[model samples]
Target: MRSLTEQDIRSSFVNCSKGEAKRLAIPRDLDERPWADLDFLGWRDPGAPDRSYLVTERAGRLVGIALRFPSSQRGFLHRSMCSLCLTTHPGNGVSLMTARKAGAAGREGNSVGIYMCTDLACPLYIRGKKVPEAGGRFEETLTTEQQLARMTDNLSAFLDKLHA
Candidate 1:
């Protein structure tokens, strides 16, 4: 992923109105993001914990989506997995993030949801830069490259649904 500016992110949104995009919070650490390690940029709004955002370069263009999720903390004993990166976490570490569909469907309140990292840090988790305290265990035989490809594919599919 490449570093994106506030303007770039605001303009990349496909599911929200221009005015809404302009008003939503953009990450304050854009310049400090590790772009080389990212497949997409995602963050929850500090002002509104239930609100989140994701942006990525797809099919030669930047695409972004606004998301919503439960703000309440989860029980510590349960485990959940991120649909994109497949990293398992204590229940509190995952949330059901939902994105409104692009265009008309979104305007009508239709949305799609999936379990994802609560902090939207799938890239770091997958790259081993951030480790879960519980330690993730994968029984699959795929190599790291294959796992990464799968993650990309899953995200693409999610984006496709948003665009559908």
Candidate 2:
């Protein structure tokens, strides 16, 4: 992934109005992000707890989506897996995030949802750069590269659905 500027992010949004994207919070540490290690940029809105965002390069252009989810905490004892990176976490660490579809469908109130890491750190989790509190343990034959590719593919598929 390439490092993105605030303007780049604001303009990349596909699921929200330009005005809304302009008003949403952009991460302050854009320059400090681990771009080389990222498949997409994901972050929760600091000012709006129920809102989140994701940005990724699709084809030759950047595409972004705005997501909404409940702020309530889930019980820590239950285990759940992130649909993106396949990392297991305590139930509280995952959430159902929904993104309004792009264009006309979005204006008509259509949206898509998926279970993802609450913190949206799938890239780091798969690379072993970050570990969840529940400690995901997987006995898999796939290498890190393979896992990362799968994550990217999964995310792209989700983005495609939003466009569809």
Candidate 3:
């Protein structure tokens, strides 16, 4: 992953209106992000808790999508696995993030959802930069690079669904 500018992020959005993308929050601490450790940049909107965003370089281009999760705490009390990285976390560490599909499908209210790390820190969890309360990552025969490849595959599939 490469460090992204605010303009880069705002212009990368594919699923939302240009005006909405302009108004969406980009992280204030972009300079401090661990860019080398990221497969995608994800963040929840501080002013709108249920809203979130994800941006990544896919197919040789930057693609971004706005996401939303249920605001109520209905599903945050138990351990869950992030579908993208397969990292498990206890309590509110995982969330069901959904993104509206791009183009007319989005206008028709079509969307897709997946269980993901609430903080959008899948790479961190996989690389031991962050630990899950579920007592860390499960022991696996795969190397870090393999794990990263798996995560990227999962993310690409998700992005494909949006563009489908």
| Residue 82, model 1: Cα distance from true site in angstroms | 0.8
Best by lDDT: 2
Clashing pairs in 2: none
Tens-digit lDDT track of model 3 for 84-164: 988887776778999999999999999999999888989988988998775357899999999999999999999999989
Model 3 alpha-carbon miss at residue 2, Å: 0.7
lDDT of 3: 0.90
Candidate 3 differs from the real structure by a C-alpha RMSD in angstroms, to one decimal, of 1.3
For 47-67, candidate 2 gives per-residue lDDT tens digits of 999999999998989998999
- Please name the candidate that would achieve the greatest TM-score relative to the true structure: 2
- Sort the predicted structures by TM-score, highest score first: 2, 3, 1
Ordering by lDDT: 2, 3, 1
Residues 21-104 of candidate 1 have per-residue lDDT tens digits of 999999889999999999899998999979999998998999999999987887789899889888888867888989999989
TM-score of each: 0.95, 0.97, 0.95
RMSD of each: 1.3, 0.9, 1.3
Candidate 1 ranges beyond 4 A from true positions: 135-140
lDDT score, candidate 2: 0.91
